[model samples]
Target: MTTTAPVTTPKEKTGAETALADSWRVVVLNDPVNLMSYVVLVFRKVFGFDEATARRHMLEVHERGRSVVWRGVREQAEAYAYTLHEWHLTAILERNETD
Candidate 1:
């Protein structure tokens, strides 16, 4: 048996588009409210990043002002940012500058 993918025409975008092709970053900002370990856990639990990477990103947010937790399509980036917000974490979406 063989499977075939469906065909569709590319639609033109109306509003402003990002620099990169289907890529955005979910950034987490550093705050005085959350604990270091808690931030790591949030990265792991929310973004599914492993402990080491999570800790690394968490540290970046700690020492620096923010860190890009994830990079993907805008929809996913917004979703992740919203989830982090729900978890009481500061997060935002940034369009990928490099395509």
Candidate 2:
């Protein structure tokens, strides 16, 4: 007599689970409280961005009201956004539209 492997079926993902699988963006929104210099400093400290790159993102937030600082998987984006918030920056997570 011989044994055979059992069959298995893949489960379909629900809407919320599908949404979580999509990419996410970490955005830093401009706020009245944080100064331009301080924003740049925080960007550098939190993200390890160099002076020029940090300044670029800071200016984007200052002039454009917000900047997409990082884009990646949802979990990491959430962590980055949370870290920025912990640093007192106005950071938020947004679903990446292109995903």
The top-ranked prediction according to lDDT is 2
lDDT (C-alpha) at residue 72 in model 1: 80
In model 2, what lDDT does residue 17 have? Answer: 76
Model 1: per-residue Cα lDDT over 1-99, one tens digit each:
999998998987744453366789888998999999999998889878899999999899999989988888898899899999998999988888754
Worst 10 residues of 1 by lDDT: 13-22
lDDT, candidates in the order shown = 0.87, 0.89
- The ten-residue window of minimal lDDT in model 2 covers 14-23
Which stretches of candidate 1 lie above 4 Å from their native place?
A: 1-19
The per-residue C-alpha lDDT of model 2 at residue 29 equals 94
lDDT of prediction 1:
0.87
Cα distance off (Å), candidate 1, residue 25: 0.8
| Model 2 ranges with Cα > 4 A deviation | 1-21
Model 2 clashing-pair count: 0
Structural RMSD, model 1:
10.9
Question: What TM-score would each prediction reach against the true structure?
Answer: 0.77, 0.76
